[model samples]
Target chain A: MITIAVDAMGGDHAPVPEVSGAVQAASTQDVNILLVGKEQVLQAELKKFDGWKKLPIRIVNATEVVTMEDNPAKALRTKRDSSMRVAARLVRDGEAQGWISAGNTGAVMAISKTVLGMIPGVDRPALAQAFPTIKGKPAVLVDVGANVDSSAQMLAQFAVMGEIYSRLVFHTESPSVGILSIGEEDHKGNELTKSAASLMKALPLNFVGNVEGRDLYTGLTDVIVCDGFIGNVALKVSEGLVDVIKHMLKESLESTIASKIGYVLSRQAFKDFRKRMDYSEYGGAPLLGVKGVVIICHGRSNDNAIRNAIRVATESATEHVNDRIEIEIQRWQASSTNDPEV
Target chain B: MITIAVDAMGGDHAPVPEVSGAVQAASTQDVNILLVGKEQVLQAELKKFDGWKKLPIRIVNATEVVTMEDNPAKALRTKRDSSMRVAARLVRDGEAQGWISAGNTGAVMAISKTVLGMIPGVDRPALAQAFPTIKGKPAVLVDVGANVDSSAQMLAQFAVMGEIYSRLVFHTESPSVGILSIGEEDHKGNELTKSAASLMKALPLNFVGNVEGRDLYTGLTDVIVCDGFIGNVALKVSEGLVDVIKHMLKESLESTIASKIGYVLSRQAFKDFRKRMDYSEYGGAPLLGVKGVVIICHGRSNDNAIRNAIRVATESATEHVNDRIEIEIQRWQASSTNDPEV
Candidate 1:
């Protein structure tokens, strides 16, 4: 069975959701989970669930917790035995195949990188987020809030990583990658995207030129690459707009008696729609280009999100995604060195 | 009477929506409309609308038309007598108080800036888009695809211009301005936003520091400023997400007979919701920092959008928004030079 480490002292309401999610995953999936946190708090939470003792879940003691307010560098240096750090250590020490956290994102990234190290030939790791497209399949958007002020070469690397993730995880035959920009034309982006476009075009992958923001949901490309700043803004803006739309729909459906009855009758259809758009269904975003499998969930993720994240981590680990990434990175570096066009 | 010029040969479906919208605006509002386009085409379209001859609308002949595929620079130099250029010339020659176009965005910006000139002390003009906020008030987002690769000083100028636009056009008192970034912390942005933040802080405007993409619709700040590339992507992404949500809602409502019935019952409420979210209601985004009032509409705009653009252009002209923008820009420039913090 694949072993996964869960940071139980992370997240907004830690220990409870983390333990509950581990129990659910261990009970259903063929996996073992180590809940890293204060042993007593995790044990107390586990007692509330029936048959959790029979599940392949265990408590791993952690002496400290990293608060949300703590800076990433400070948390990495100071909180040596924090739950997040302990989780990363478990993966590094071969105690677990993968690690999952729902904590301060920067702290989780820093600790995971410091402990697990970087895959050879990779300059920086990226966060690859899966977005549900209009064509009923998920697409990967890479470098979503991982590093800022990235260079053209970094963006080109992200495109390759995102393409591989789409092919392996999403099961695309051959993923087509596009760089996000203001327009779909070749000459239409800021300086970063413009230079990145040239670099990406010369790569061995299927590089479809530039794409605009409207194409994000169009499913025209299997993978989209952008800098962390633009990618993060796009992600958050989509979330905000979706919330406002849902709010508007709710207000309209409850405004009158007829509409209220209609809403009740059509509740199942709405439920299905909600499930399709729910972020928790996709689990967590994977930190690519890292030496080990590390999945990072939102700070406010719930039990369902955590359980799904574990499932994703198990699949990623079992597939040996990191090994494949290292192979691809080495091949890319060789091609760039030999290709006269580059 | 306040006279407004309409580019009758612009938009995806030229002359039809323009002439119809001009007739509606002239009949309803206390304004005169100049339809600038091919004389014969304008006459043919005007003939389809009954009683248009009795309205305060006149057709101005233009010998050329700028197609969508034409480059902005090329169109400016070659198509000097095009409908868009003729309309801008009308505004510049004191025959019209303002001008409205639903043509190519780049072409419109190029022609308007060349014809009307720039407000003193303003380096580059910006496009300020008004968005409906959760608090039921509109917030202005500036530099929406005007200039890319902007400097820190230019961003500071955008903040000042956006502040003036919000206060004058939206009628917000002492508007609060914020810089768009990845995080809300003062130190959470890229190099561009970081340097821009310091410059904005030294200005005399009510600077609220940094805001994230989620704050775009929260009504927390009256104005949000960003570089054109980021601003354009944010605007387009919001639009794309809204379209997807609406599509999902429609698909769900049609999945079952019960939902179909519910949709019928809730049709009025849904209509109200649609009206509130409709882009036509808010009209075109005003191009601020220009010497004259200019409103640029979407290429796919309908009759209602054109009519509303006319209304907005009239209001902007009546308020002397350009003069106000000039005064505030001069004040910001003076303060930036004298402030020690800068």
Candidate 2:
């Protein structure tokens, strides 16, 4: 059975949700789970479940905990025995096929990259998240917050990784990749996007031309790639705007009795809308380009989010996504070196 | 009476909406209007409106028009007698206090900047748009598409311009200004935002620290400043996402007969929601840092949007916003020079 390590002391509501989610995943999915945290705390939390003794779940103890306020670099260097660090170590030692955490994102990235190391020929790991599109499908956005400042080559690498992930996860035969920019014209956009577009065109994948910000929700392309800074800003801004629209709609609907009745009738539609927009439905973003699978969830993730993240980690490991990424990167490198003009 | 020039031969449905909007503004507002376009074409369009001759609207003859596809700089140079150019000339020749255009944004900006020139101490002009916030108010986002690659100093200038516009337009006593970044922390951002934050702190304004993308709708700050590239991307992304959400809601609601009845009952509430979200309600974005008041509306703007744009131009010119911006820039410059550390 494929094994996964999870940080049990991470996220806003930890230990309880983490333990419950692990138990749920282990019971439903064909995977063994190693819950990494304080043994006493985790054991107590896990005992509350009815059939906890039957699942393929075990506890791994770690003395330290990394708080959200701790500097990521400093925490990675100092908190050697932290739950997040121990989970990463388990992946490195081959005891677990992948690791999942909803803790401090920066600390998780630093520790996971440092412990499991980078896949050969990959410059840096990128965070890829799925956003629902108008086509009733989800699109993958890469480098959401992993690399703030990225080169054209790095963006090209993101395109490759995003394409592979979209195909494997979404089951698309040939995913169309687009470089995010302010305008659709080839000549438009800042220096980075323009250069990235040229490099992406040289790849073996199906590369659509430059796409504007509007294309994100239009589902004009299956995979959208950009630097971490812009991707992070776009993702957060979309989240905030959605909240604002919902608030305004609620306020407007409550202004009159007729509208209130209308809201009750359309309540089912709103429920469906919320479910589709919910972040937990997509689980967590996978940190691609690492040697081993590492899924990072939002810090405010709940029990459902944790369970879904575990599900994502298991799927990624079972699919052998990392092996495919290595093969793609090697092919891209070989092509680039063979053609001097590229 | 204040006078505003209109580009009558611009936008998707030119001369009809343009002429009708001018007549509507002239009759309702206390302003004289100069409609610039081909004399015969505008006269034919104006003839359809009753009491058009009684309004304080005058027609000026122009031989050419600037299409949306034309290169901005080239059009500015070659289309000397175009309607957009003639409107800018009216402002320069002291015939009108300001100009409004629902034409090509880049062409309008180029012509306005070249003809009217920059206010003293201002490096570049910025485009400012008001976005509805959750607080039932609006926040101004500056440099929406003016400068793609802005320096730290230019971003500081945008903050000053945005602050003044927020105080005058939104009527806030002391508008809180924020530099848009990926994170709320001072140390978390790309090179540009980091450097811009340090410079903004030196200015004598109510400067809030760095804000995240989520802060845009939270109404955490009255004015959000960033390079045009990022701001443009953020603005378009918001607009596109809103459309997608609305489309999804409509699709979801129409799936059932009960929901269809609910939609009819809540139709008024949806109308109210759309009115609140409509860009036309905010009139047009002002091209701040320019010597003359120049407002740019969307190319697809209707008569209501055009009319509101004329209203905005009148208010800006009457309030002498250009003078206030000059004064604020001088004050900031004086403070910066006096403080050696800054």
Candidate 3:
């Protein structure tokens, strides 16, 4: 049975959404949840459920909770008994298959690396968030908010991992990979992107040349790998743009009755767009290159988001992706090292 | 007189808009236009103009043109007689107070640095773009598509330049500066942003820690600094979002009578929003931290954009922003170097 650990004290709607989402996940599958947090608080929340105790849901009490303001390193160093830390410790000790946290992002990353460690041969773990394309297929954007200042080699490594993850999850045999750049031209971008593009060109994959930010919505590439800084900026900027447009649409629609009817007729498509952009439904971002399946949920996750995170974790654990990533990276490194162009 | 060199053979619309824009700019009392391109073509376009060429418009002959597809460095080297190249050279040779090109951006940047050289103590120049906020104020986004993979020091330098530019150009004193990051929390973001935030904290400027992408529209910060890769991505994504929404709104309004009425009444507000977000009005991005003033306009610019670019260049040159930037950066560097925290 797939085992999942949940940080019950995390998120904006902590305990309530966490317990409900976990219980909901447990009821649907033969999965055991080690709910790490205060037993009194969780037990109080749990009693509100309708016989959820029969669904293999158990509470593992911990005295401490890591506040959002807590320094990630210091919290991991000192809060040896906190729910977030202990939950990660369980995954590290092999008691749990995957760990999920909707706590502070820094805390989640810090605890995971300190406890679970990086996958062998993986330089640093990357955060990969999946965005649904116009085609309804997911495009994996790696290092969205992880490692910055990555070398060209690391970028190539991200491409391999992104390809594997996209293929396994989205079931695409030949996923097109792209590097983000200012211009579509070969010699358009700065040194890092140019060098990374060259490296991607030499790779044994369906490597498309540079794609601009406009290509993200066009669904031109299956996987987009960028440095965490750029990736995060792109992700956040895209999200903000969506919000702005949505607001504009609302303001425009409410101004007229005919437009409102038009909006109603097109409601299905608008809802489809909203669902396509929804991160909660896709679950948490996976910390790629981690030894175990470490999913980083949003700090403001609700019941549905947490459940989705658990579902993603279970699927990834079953696939044994870490094993495949290890072999792929090694094979790629060896193959590319012997080649002159690389 | 503020003498500005305009590359007439540059943009997609070439001399048509370039000549018209120069004629328009010449209408301003303090402006003189040195129209740089093939004399015959420029004069032909100038003749079609509605009576203003006799003012201070002069034609400079340039035999060649730089296409967007050509390699920037290679084209700059080979096309020494190109209108774009001569315009840059004129700025370097101090024959013009400033240079404006709505042509090949890559060639412009490469040629500008090669011809004019960098201002002393400035490592790399930044392409800062001015954006209008919903609050009716403007925010200067630095490194818009320049200096990709920029370091914390480079970003810090951008913050300084952006501050001075915003103050002198937009007339905002002690404008709030924000480093774009994934999370608004102080501890979030990649190494570059985190380091830059720390460096910004130590500067004399009013640094407003971290900002999310949505904060841009809300007018939460006056200046935003990020690497060119991210900046460019944000620019394109935001532009695409706006376009998509505008198309949807127009489609919705065309379908019904009530919607038509609503559209008519809300037309002013919608126009205001459109005008605020319209990037073309800003003319072009200034090549900041360069010794001489240079503005890189959009490759697809028309006459109005070219004219606006010339006006922008004239204002920047008249303000002596390049010289002011040197003193500001040097003083900031000198003062912050010996801080006790350092």
Best prediction by TM-score: 1
Sort by TM-score, best first.
Answer: 1, 2, 3
Instruction: Looking at model 1 chain B, report the run of 10 residues with the lowest lDDT sum.
Output: B333-342
> What ranges in model 3 sit over 4 Å off?
A23-34, A49-56, A89-96, A185-191, A194-203, A245-272, A333-342, B16-30, B43-59, B89-95, B148-156, B179-203, B209-217, B240-272, B330-342
Give model 2's TM-score versus the native structure. Answer: 0.97
Put down candidate 2 lDDT per residue, A1-342, tens digits, no spaces. Answer: 899999998777787778888988898889999999999999889889988888999999998888888899999999999999999999999999999998999999999889999988899899999888898788899989999879999999999998888898777789999988877779888888889999998889899878788789998799999889889888999999998889999999989999999999999988888877787778799999999999998888877888888888988898888999999999889978898786
lDDT of 2 by residue, B230-331 (tens): 888888889889999999999888988888888999999999999888888888899999889999988888899999999889988887889999998998
Q: Residue B286's C-alpha lDDT in candidate 3?
A: 93
Clashing pairs in 2: none
Error of 2 at A285 (Å): 0.7
Interface RMSD values, listed in order for every candidate: 1.1, 0.8, 4.7
- Taking all chains together, each candidate's TM-score versus the true structure is 0.98, 0.97, 0.86
List the RMSD of every prediction in angstroms.
1.3, 1.5, 4.0
- Which candidate has the highest lDDT of all? 2
- Clash totals for all candidate models: 0, 0, 1
What digit string (tens of lDDT, one per residue) describes model 3 on residues A1-342? 989899999787788889999999998866888899999999999999889868888888888998888888898889989998888878878888887888877788888888888877788888888875655577888888777778887888898888888888667779999987887889778788899998888788899888888777566789988888778778777776666656654665565665556555555555545655687888889888888888888778888889988888887788887888999888877886897866
